[model samples]
Target chain A: MPKAPRAVVLLGAQRFDPTLVEAVKDLGIKGRIAAITAGWQEREEEDDDLEEHLATLSVTTENLRLHARAEEVFRADPEFHKAHRERQALLRHRQDFYRIRLEHALDAAQVIRQRQAPEAILEDEAHASIQAIRDLDHMHLSRCAIDRGEFEDRYRPLKRPALAKHRSEIAEIIAGSEGVAIAGGHVASLLNRLDLFGIAPMLGGKAIFAWCAGAMAISERVVLFHDSPPQGVGAAEVLDAGLGLAPGVVVLPQPEFRLRLDDKERVQLMARRFAPAVCLAMPERSRARWKSGRVESQQGGVFELREDGTHALSVARHSVPPMKGHVAS
Target chain B: MTGLTPLAITTLMMPGTDARKVDEFLAGKQFPLTEGPNVTFVWRGDAEGVNLRHWIYGLETATALSRLPHTDLWFLTLDIPEGSRIEYKFEVLRNGKGEWIEDPRNPNRARDPFGANSVLQAVGYEAPDWSTKDDLARPGTIDQLVFDSPSLEGRRNVQMYLPARFRRSRQYPLVVVHDGKDYLNYASMKEVLDNLIHRLEIPDVIVAFTDSPDRLREYANDEAHARFLTEELVPDLAARFPLYDRPQARCLMGASFGAVASFSTACRYPGFWGRLLLQSGSFAFTDIGKRNRRGPLFDRVVEFMNRYRNEPVAVSERIFVSCGVYESLIYENRSMVPLLDATGMQVRFVEARDGHNWENWRDRLREGLSWVFPGPLMFVYE
Candidate 1:
């Protein structure tokens, strides 16, 4: 039987959006697929949606739960637990400082947006404002990585027997399955489980489909951003360093909700701040596929932010070539 | 506000009843229910000498009914708005207690997160059968478009609701709603429109479910958002669809900040979008730029609202404002009513007892749509 090429497929939100199912079916695999849904917290077994989708294609599924089994890790390794707590505390402190700087920079940007400053002055102010935010993010993200790495190096939590049991179980599951489906939720929770179990190595280059926090977890860095929330304005924070799987892009899921994409200054600042890492806007139905370490298709209405505070669709739509223009300050 | 008189009287043919004849009345005809433009809602065996009002239209929306002529049939023959789907319950003063009870006879009901309420589709109003998916009916098509906005310098996916009877050749009234997905999914607007258009309650219109990439920043009376709607989107829509060009045929709508977006668009582009359907709008404003003390999220929103208040410009020709009585922003919406009414624009204000939610906005859709786009067939009895 002809099979789809083994690859990593990054998708948008899948709770309501069934793009993941479509991607999984397109893989053309009849074998059982392992699933990671620790990100969903306690309600991990509620895999009815994924199950329903797979049932249509007649694919057997194995929903691997790291969340339900995290108690073992905590129970066995007291040192790892302490280290993890310290690391979380440090991360929180780092976030507080980052937030202060972010707030200040955002205030400056708001002032700049409202100001009728000269073009040169406006550009300078905007440039500095964006730089400040970028510096803050970079510093925070770096600090988080160092802190987590130090904890891991000191504790060697992955080597703990409690987690070792889960690792063997996950490895066995992945060995049988031709692919893996990772659903999104709490990104930290998802990453913690994935790292604890160390299932990435067991994948053996099998095809993986992930979306939302799942996609964010596999990225180089997981950024949490929301422009306006119910309580107040929200600043985008680099949550933590992700598993270096979906390389080189800030996966901003629900861009429709979080990003003020319409605002030139905000969008432009975001583009420049996250320079090099293509800040990919993944709303529902957005898709980006990586085959053999190469991004093959970013065609499912995927958009990439540019340096000049403008975004263009990664794929063409309705034969209308991508609109290209730098935003006027 | 203009007062309306009942066009016709509708009498129940069943036997007259008091508390003694309750069983007989029950066996004969369903009490507390009537049909017509002027239909009396009867509540059997009510104890008088207490504050009581018939909860009509929506939750907490009530009217006092006079005891019907010569019987215990407590009835009020109200000439309801020509085309309206009203929800009502009885507040009976019985056993020294006043409690609300749904019209047991009326089978039509609508439920939200709160609870259920009995619905009344008036003579001219037809309850959308498509509100519930019917296999027999041909469903309307919803074409999703990822529009690259030139004005705002971004891309947003808009869900366009084209009626089953849609044709490119015919110019249709255009209704642009904010929070496209919420209305379509949460509010079940596609179903409502499908049924409405199917039954000819509303005209076959082109609905552009325009979503906000960032709702708070854009919809808080933001200039960029206004430009995006009027400048970027409108022209794009005109080129694509057979849209009615006149302002009268164009409706800009939304709820919460979405309402602010529609209103701000109307203020910015006065002659462009004339029909406004604002549901539970966050018309946040402060005098002399004194911020709302809540947070800075609404600071700019207040600034814009104040600007509109200071310079009260005639935004639209006809406007329908719906809000929930239990909402925190009730004052804001209520304040906007008089402000809008004073602007020489036809303004209709409606409210329900429920809190601010998608369902509250959803229930107001039929009333708002029918009034805004009554088409040529619906006679305007002024």
Candidate 2:
């Protein structure tokens, strides 16, 4: 079996304001870094901004073009493409059913918590409410896993010739590179491409840097969340089981824009519902590192949300570990 | 003096004030003074009677201002609602003659086809920060496409907004806008598109802005106009540009009469444009008779609206309607929402404290555009 990654660095939105350079410099990595921007879909090869940013620190960048590869695979194997579409439809149906249950459960929890009662009773009810949500989340996640597991069992897509060839090519690229950087895009697309290529195992022992959907794709479970959507009620839902590379953490990217942190009830509910796994809010320019199966370091408004609803993220810069390699010329 | 606004101090309490005090008060201050929901419009010239001339429906069009006893300052304080944007002009009566002019003291003005009016943004009313030009946002290029349309039997000019990072290899959602030049000039549309696209609030899109020489005649549910858009313009643009060949990737947007053009076009070609962003649409309809209060200009519009009301269909999948409460068309717009929603299409109607002008349409662009064609930001980012 492949060993665990050296460090799983999760950053915030890296489109307009990127902190990949700082993350790279801190890691003392000055060599070739493989990039997976499959989430960008048709615009997969548009990594000029990212390349330029990393180039400032003399870090050579290589876009793996997994999205393009997936397209090629689909074109080459129409049967695989049809199966993938069918699987996607199955997952979507499961999600719709799960949403119906999750919404009612979440509403019941909120109602119970807000009811007029004694302090002790209210506290107990709040706990129960959180537990109910957590239970539903676990149930939903398990059902999704079964759906995905069944599909994987039936298809055995990794054994397919096209995917296998690309996986080998990708593994070889990662082997040559020092680290892998994954940029943000549509989360579901990113997760799908990553799973299709089976690039998780190949990331072993390499410094893995990801942000936005990229960060979410690496976690044990991917949660789709937005506090205020334009049309519908914003509910956090379990998308699917992620790569499981970074465990015991629910990453919320662009929290400042996506979440209403001022609403204490909402903050408390979100934090408590995802207990055991720390609910980390990664705003722009924020960074959090997962090492040894836990968050070892964080900085730049990287917040650990608690049930109290306080939003005082420590702005003080943390000390960086000593450099192990010389600066690139 | 401790807790009152500057205008309140000068207008209410001061019994023995001079021109120096009034000049001092007016200096270095932005007008009109907006404190909470109350807006005080101040005029600093000598006149027999100064009236606030506005077009806000349901309110007295011409409201007289009270002059200070010792100074030439005339002021009128009206309790405006939060998030309401009103526009008005000052009708100064000098030497027994009334001369209408834009607010000399206020720099914020909104221009329209008719003329210009001074803008008053109450508390909680702010033009989206993205409406302004940002140096960081890479600007898009606009290319003109002049073509002869057999449907309309005339030559038409359309300007295209290609996003800063537009690539021919990638397919883009297209939004065809009516009264294109007016939006570009008055609404700062290019700046808005640049900023929204740069910030990822909306995807990189190909916007086709179209104009008509005779909008009143052409845009009022004209079948030829509809044909020109659905047949002539859209197909031509699709062939020229890399556009997604699906209804969900297409949109038609306009304001007022322009909105009538978009609505009628979509009705003509149902399921062709998946989204419709209609702002203050001139959807004039009567419950009984064919005549409308908006007069002869809205005859064709009212005729079409009446017919659609009788037999409404789900022309598009989603629609975004925004109308200013201050405009005369608010009632028509408000009534149309339920009818549109009942057609089984997803409908969103937004009402602003504004009037029927370009700026009112401009202010609601973020909400209307983002909902219709959301970018990567609106997607699930975990």
Candidate 3:
């Protein structure tokens, strides 16, 4: 039997989109894949447990990776390392100062606890914890070496090696596979960096699959909704860039049943706000597949957002014909 | 202040007797009753076979008072606004005349902030449900269990609520809610979970409601509270139940002070929680003293966001944030939601119609839960 294709899932701040599983299954792949979480600072024990869970889920463990970008090495260089070390030392010192301040706070808390009862103590503990972390984060950032403008520029180069390594490993896993599925929202960021570093030509002849943030990142432009000054990452920064691998803008997965009626309205508004961008809104557990730019409903129905801002939904039927291709100019 | 005089009077009514009943009886006797700071009555009563004019004022709040006759009236003049409703009870003298009574004008009553009992009325707002009965009595499947500060036993209350399809044997994702009383019961959180679970909107998950009574003092101080959770609570919960035994299966949630706790805890510990639900969090409280005195907590929250802006966060840990348009803290919550998202956390922002009350918090629970547990619905039939 042929070795199954391997995939990488870049989780968003929310839960994983279930449609990725279906997309993978449809691609005739049956192998364990790695789920890489890239955003937050994690506790060691928790990180270990998460790795164990993903491994249990059959994702390849040997190659499981984190975003240990080469920037750390650059920052650690002797010339730059001094500034970094000094900043780190300052952060550590400030943290210690705050910890002492907390002793006074704890003492006050004890008095309140004595008067109020056990519950008061619990509330006090939670308050103290939140304060300490907030203080620590503030202390660390005030001492960071890079400014926002310089940081963004420098950050681009730093991402290249990480993406190259990820791609090479993925290439090895899916050596002879006809198609590969890249599940996750952050995958687009990796794809974009790959194109920037001129690594896209290296993985020729392989079909690409993307969903949620993964799909959004691979499109002509990845829309950053969560960003205040909405950012758009282009094909160079977005790895899949229609990958010529598929067509049409992938509507990332969202929630199906919104708690508030306004939530649906907000999502629709987002789609409208990005008009002519071929906005695709995939609800949780649902998916949309694009072949050669023409979108088709798969598992989940496809909703076409017209230029007039009106949306049309076509339900999924067993006898539906496969969608044709249309190039995004 | 001309009429202000220190007066002392003690009245008693029979136990278990409604004070209002006596007031009604006195009303029929053609006595003049005036209620201000207390209930005062001037009535003609026969004393030793001679008719005498008597005055009575109820200074204490009582449902029942000891019965007495020939009461001596010690009247104190007090300046009170007209139409003001006060609560008081009358005291009887040695002469068997006056008895304790309730204020007729103000039937509603409330507890005074001070230790001494006084007369007042209920503010007409609905009181929180303090009844400790668990309507859903069966032990719920443990999705995630966290125990913080084991050495401080009995000081904490471990609260657990199972999703609609909860079962004893099945392991589920655990979302731990800080300020458990406010989130689970006071906010009608269980109902939100039930609706989401039943609709297949969100995946089946276990919710551990951790009590945080001293929230203001502890949550934002030293992460000692988070340590209690990560070190103590997680271990204790894991051992006792079949919860999702991994960090990816764990989540943390809170609002206001609780919100700061949830965000700070997750950021500090990172992979410990896969999801975070924060509503009207005070993210901007930068200076603790200033925040405690006059500044809103949002100042500190902004400091937290700026610091962690580029830190590698649990990119996989999803976050849901909501705030009422009328709530003063909405701006902070809104700004933090995107900040967390920019740092690579999955974040959903929501705006509601209400304020920072249980009603709005209750509504956000279902939406927030669904965001964290989006997957195929699994129903556990009892």
Candidate 4:
């Protein structure tokens, strides 16, 4: 059999969503697939357990470490130190606030618990009342992060060793794989760095697959929607060129939950402004296969564009059902 | 010890009202209160009569009033447009005090960072140029024509966009889009193509927007709509335009259910369409609850794939796929991406931060068209 394509899996910033890994395996073109967990500096014992689980799939898991020299540079940077201090302060404040809130909430729950009397005529109702209080307390504690404005900064920074290891492992994976699949937050940044280091070129002869952030990183440009005054990353903004694995603009995938017209228009405007070599929008589960220049869809999906100043939709046969009710006559 | 204080009085007046007397009284005076609309008279709290302290007035009350009193008030009566609802506010000295306050007369107010308060009239939008329907007529090249699909009679309308460079002189690629009206009219697709072609982004191409006929049934069934595009519409468009006779030059694109049609048609007739652009396609056969009640659409898709897995693509074609970052169907799209890539076909997958919509689709059009036809004549803005 054709050597199963060697595969490299990158996981660092975001926790791996199990469903994403299963999807990769389902593709069936596999050799050795490895997961490099290099985003976090200090790995807890629980992380080792997760690594073990990943190993069961014939995928090796390793933690990449940064060199001492890089660590020295990071420590010497005043701005980095300042930012780190601010983050620490913010974290402490949040922790204190949450602790107080949790205490208060638990106290309220205890009060409700004490009100439940065994002799009460409505025993089930009284138990439900106590449960409801506990649920409310839990919700309050969960929402404490929002109140403290530290939700975004909650993720602790990874140590230098971990960061360097991740970069090296990703490079190694790309070099060995017949194909590579990457999924996670920070995938775009990682891809850009890899491209800069010429790691992406190693996979030039192989097929590459990226989902969500991973997909965005491989494109010519990655548009970040998380920032205010929306900004474009990768080649367009000169932040860093993407892996250049795919030519064109990378659209940050938009969900289909809010059925608003203006929201759709905003997305279109962003795409036009960025004007990547290609723009991709995944409103649903759609796949397009490219072969020798011919791109074909294997599922139900739609692609729209302006032609001669008019818009057109290319519909795949199997995916046209949900849209049956909305087309104009 | 001797203490002395002078009492000053000031009066307020509305715009277009006589306020010359009040202005003269407050000239060079300390603690002076300026005259404004909506205030009839004022009293001074200051001991010095030389210093006008406050002014109040019910300057004017008229339904046809042009301007109200407040900071930044400019009133020049002219023939304003009819049926216009103007917003304005009046500022007046409160109870003989120097404090000028906003009008209590106006009912409309706007919320802002400062606080909720009245605002000036908003400029109305000029009417769009709806004067001519010249676009209704078919161009000379495509011979602007309309088709009533017997398969979708009265159920759908299909619009064709022939490149401005379209000539009876040569054959051109044909691309079929599912949401005809959205592509042709709503998205200004014709203009996009014109610009793209002018910029030489893609080669000369003909676009036939075959609207979904009862989008629910046609897109869901896939068979009906696919048949309509391949069997009925393709022949019709070819007869009308100088379309390339071979399927190698043919392409399909759409989003959601429209995406389904694009892939299904290509799979069914692998030789017919050489290019495809799938944006946020609904490829998860299990999730489409009601539509797949009879049977799973995935079976058909898999069957098509199995049948055509080894078939040599007539002409090297390209496929572009993309989805939103937060879209629930992202996993499904990811799953499908590898499947398509495994077919030994060129696949470009894209992910954006938005859900399924025309905006992203319009952008995808720009990129996908360029990929499908990487030559001069594809749509691009100047």
Best by lDDT: 2
Candidate 1's residue-wise lDDT over A19-70, tens digit each? 7667877778788989888887666788888888887888889998788777
All candidates in order of DockQ, best leading: 2, 3, 4, 1
Clash count for each candidate, listed in order shown: 2, 0, 94, 126
Over B1-382, each residue of candidate 3 has an lDDT whose tens digit, in order, gives 1235322122223343344544554454321233334333332222322221111122222222222343422223343334332333334333765544343333333322121212322122232231122454222332333344554443676777766455564567777788886665456566656655544445567777887656775676336787877777777777765786666578888887788888788777867787778887766633233343335544455555556543535534577888866566766667666667666566778885445555557656656766666533211100
Residue pairs with colliding backbones in model 2 are none
Question: Considering every candidate listed, which one attains the maximal DockQ?
Answer: 2
Q: Candidate 4 on A1-329: residue-level lDDT in tens?
A: 12222232212112332333343454564454333222121221124644554445665543322222224434655554455446534543453344344435444544654675666645565445445433443443344324323422442223334344545655676566545544433432343234323344445445444555555555444443421110111111112234444443333443232112234433333344333233444334434333222233323243433212222343322111111010010
lDDT at position B321, candidate 1: 90
Alpha carbon lDDT at A277, candidate 3: 46
Interface Cα RMSD for all candidates? 19.9, 3.8, 14.4, 13.7
Tens-digit lDDT track for model 3 on A79-190?
4434433443443345335434543444454455456458867666645644543343334333322232243365443344544565566456444444443434234234
Model 2, C-alpha of A44: deviation from truth (Å): 6.7
Q: Is the docking of candidate 1 incorrect, acceptable, medium or high quality?
A: incorrect
List per-prediction Cα lDDT, in the order shown: 0.72, 0.84, 0.46, 0.45
> Candidate 3 chain A: minimum summed lDDT over ten consecutive residues — where?
A228-237
Considering chain A alone, report the TM-score of candidate 3 relative to the true chain A.
0.45
Tens-digit per-residue lDDT, B1-382, candidate 2: 2246454544544676888888777788778887677788999888999999998998999999998787888998888889988889999999999999999889888887777889988889887788999999999999999989999898999999999989886679999999999999888899989998887778899999999999999999899999899888989998999997778789999999999999999999999999999999999999999999889988999999999999999999879999999999999999999999999887889998899888988888888888788665655452
Give the worst 10-residue stretch by lDDT in candidate 4 chain A.
A320-329
The chain A TM-scores for the candidates, taken one by one, are 0.86, 0.92, 0.45, 0.44
TM values, all candidates: 0.46, 0.80, 0.37, 0.33
